[model samples]
Target: MLADPMVLILMYFVLPVWLIAGFADWLCHRATHIESTTGAKESLIHLLMFVEVGIPLLAAMFLEVNALVIAVMIVAFFVHEATAMWDVRYATTARTVGPIEQHIHSFLEMIPLMGLVSVVSLHWGQFLALFGTGTERARFDLAWKQEQLPVTYVAIVMLVIALFELLPYVEEFFRGLRANAGRLVPAKARRREAGDTAIR
Candidate 1:
């Protein structure tokens, strides 16, 4: 039920914190001049990570939180983590991933896990069903939430996501693309350029 404390925390607290962290991460990227350093490749990786996490998040918001949904959330979290590591590895090859960005990254990485824990706690029965330890059979079929979140609230959240998270990243990608233009230099090449420029 939406009134449940765990659900409330996941919906209001966890979700907002995640969004804020996401926007903050974008700010960090801009501050570090991601367009000039990491370029569009890194921006693409960012969009990939967003979708990896977004699919399960949308499902959780719109669908029933059953064994199948819980399973999806768990899987998505792991996939997102892997992608995050890839993102950082590639990024650090080209730019300085400073402490502020690293701190923002910590929140981005862990908030999904925290939200998953909250969801599992709220649907303990369904989570147990996934492990075959519950009284009810595990539900793998997707179904709409019986008690839906308010339409206005969902709309507002979606608007915030598009405005704050999605659009800004999209713009970042284009900025990188425009800056790179015809340049297809590798990360190592770019780093070498920076080093050579420093030497001169």
Candidate 2:
């Protein structure tokens, strides 16, 4: 399998894609505050993209290779790409994305396309073979093939991006909690403290 040219192509492109996606995500977070603009909605969309892409890619590494898996991956990939394109348009038109941010967005958009191309190239034969088989050929099973190290590495990078995307909402949750706590404090105690301060 390592001898396959498509496998080699995927191995080569995976790292660059992970690095570019991470950096572009950081740039986006830096360019806009989550609560102030469309950042929250955009981030949520990104989270979906991560789930769709990362999960299938990871599964493909360990699962039995089959036509059904390839079909699922193809569908997932297209959905991921669509969300990514929507993210770019949403970021650019719905909010004020800076020149640097726009550049980052454009580059980020290409990473998935390249990845899809590589994956499709790698599995093209299998996909075509599926069509030739009868309906009874459809089966999902784990082949327990040795894990692809690159898939794991990419998943880790995406996890970091997930954390970064989540941080803003986490902060907002705590801020709201604190605000509610303050409101619940005893008003009489606050007035007593104020009187003590005046007496000093």
Candidate 3:
């Protein structure tokens, strides 16, 4: 198990911890946005990123764990979170949306997706054991044991990017049909969003 250092770091150090940071951040990020439905509240997603960011790295450092493992997770989680924030910034409104509009509202919909992704990974212990951490190094040699399970991979992959990528394509396709599911934004709302609508 403690054979290849890279696998060791990946399986134990980075994979699990990164999951923690990214998933937790994702959840908190979604909750904030869903609760308010306006303003930069959703932008606070980065805050969750920070909390779990250093935890794995720091723990790895003190416990003689793998720094490389920590580094990889930090990077992956950051990319995922950063893109999400931009998606939210681009979509800043709380218009009433039907199923189609709701689908097109990528950032808003991610709230629940994020919750599922982040919350599902709260089982840190299982992640560690699966990575091969029970004997010696508890968190520095795990290598995506989950990947071995194709079905699990499917679920994991879907949970990760389903909302961001898949949902958009579906929405756009249906949108072209003027399906009864979507909405043409009111001219006034569009104007307001465009900074043309006058204030009361």
Candidate 4:
């Protein structure tokens, strides 16, 4: 499995590209000052999309690539697509999504599909068995990879995800929340200011 070009693409190319794209997307959000405009609501949506893709990603990394895993990947890709649409629609309403961000969004959207295709290619027999047409039998049981990925590589990936993807987004959410909180003015304070103005 390790020597296969498809697996190589998945491990060396697809994974790194996806991580880079995710970090780039986060930078785009920061550049647009999403915290001030769309606020935490938009940040929340971003986190949701992260989880949608993250689940299948983790599955593929650790679990055996079987019918169940392929099915999860396919379903997740569609769900991510729907969430991406929602994110753009909501984001455009309140923030400026410039050309750079738009391009980054394109990467963010397509990388998962690319990864899914590679996975299906690597596990073609299982994928075909999914629809009952393949020579191989479909296995849906959840089991770890027979030969696990190198510990150092998995550690690096997890660190990158936490530092680049997860932490940055979580910080973005808090920034949005704090910005929104600061904008809130009490009705009583407003009325008091209004009365004072009348007296002047």
Candidate 5:
């Protein structure tokens, strides 16, 4: 399957989409952090990204190309689109996205569909084959014989994006924890410690 031209084409096409979208998301997240927003919309957008990339990657690696898989992709696509629209609405209404940022957001929103199309085109034959007689049942078997490289590459890309989205939150969480720890400690205890140090 890796030898197939369609597969090769999709493999190449998906990389830029992954990079561009991931970068846009990272930029938006950085802005959100800098502005110190509530992060509700940012959180949802990242969650949607995880779902959009994660499910398809897993399905391509582990599951057979079949009607059920296509159905799942369709559902996931719609859900992602819905969340994406909501994200845009929230950002625009909240004035979180500025003029320059809107261009990045537009590109981020548009390119995912091309990625989806690439996946579907690569599996188009299998999808058509399912419509033939006696092939309607779901296939849960692993696609070890299929082209695993694209799936692996996509998985790595998603992992990178996941890290980009998560690292800031992780840092913020630890910082908050440390600050709260300080706040929880008694002021009298801190002052006593400080006094003991001064005396020493």
Candidate 6:
């Protein structure tokens, strides 16, 4: 329940940007899954991505903007945009990745980042403790530094790695990806031996 003009402005400001960014990510992700490596110019993915990255920074341009919120939003989009850029780079290389792999990768990256962003937004309620959302006083401040800073910083940094380093570190990830996959296969030889003994 937010009623103040500032909250209203932030809502108006954030919703449209979220819609645009989410749509862009959806389209780009779809293209990666369908075409997997060949849909660029025809795709509005890049245009949408730019909008996404720009929105939070745009919000920050005002002198009254909340640094903590703006920082979270900016870092969130930074991670997202960086991921998009890496996808483009990897597709250009056209190495071992395919549609399923591309699809799997994009979605996997998004899940946790979204959760961290959620925490940043929700904690606004906790710090204010006013049973509502949006007000002039809701502007992010250092009043709660002992509580907010470290958690937000760590979350932002983790998302940044996923976005920026994900592609370059593909080889390192693959070893884990394959290892987890192998764990799923079960010990086939043991099963086979059991079956043979039963047959006898």
TM-score each candidate. Answer: 0.91, 0.62, 0.28, 0.89, 0.64, 0.31
For every candidate structure, what is the RMSD over all alpha carbons to the true structure, in angstroms? 3.1, 11.7, 12.9, 7.6, 11.3, 16.7
For each candidate, what is the lDDT? 0.86, 0.56, 0.39, 0.83, 0.55, 0.41
In candidate 1, position 35 carries an lDDT of 82
lDDT tens readout by residue for model 5, 38-137? 2343444555566675686567545656656766676777777787776555444322455666677676666656656766676665566556644344
Comparison by lDDT, 1 against 5, better one: 1
Instruction: List candidate 4 stretches off by more than 4 Å.
Output: 182-200
Q: How does candidate 5 fare on TM-score?
A: 0.64
lDDT of 3 by residue, 146-170 (tens): 3242455446644644454334333
Worst 10 residues of 6 by lDDT: 191-200
Off by over 4 Å in 5: 32-35, 129-147, 150-159, 165-200
Q: List the residue pairs that clash in candidate 1.
A: none
Could you give me the TM-score of model 6 versus the true structure? 0.31
Candidate 2: list runs displaced more than 4 Å. 3-5, 92-94, 133-140, 146-200
Worst 10-residue stretch by lDDT in candidate 3? Answer: 191-200
Which is the winner by lDDT between candidate 4 and candidate 6? 4
How well does candidate 4 match the true structure in TM-score terms? 0.89
Q: Roughly what TM-score does model 2 have, to 2 decimal places?
A: 0.62
Report how far residue 82 has shifted in candidate 1, in Å. 0.4
| Decreasing lDDT order of the candidates | 1, 4, 2, 5, 6, 3
lDDT of 6: 0.41
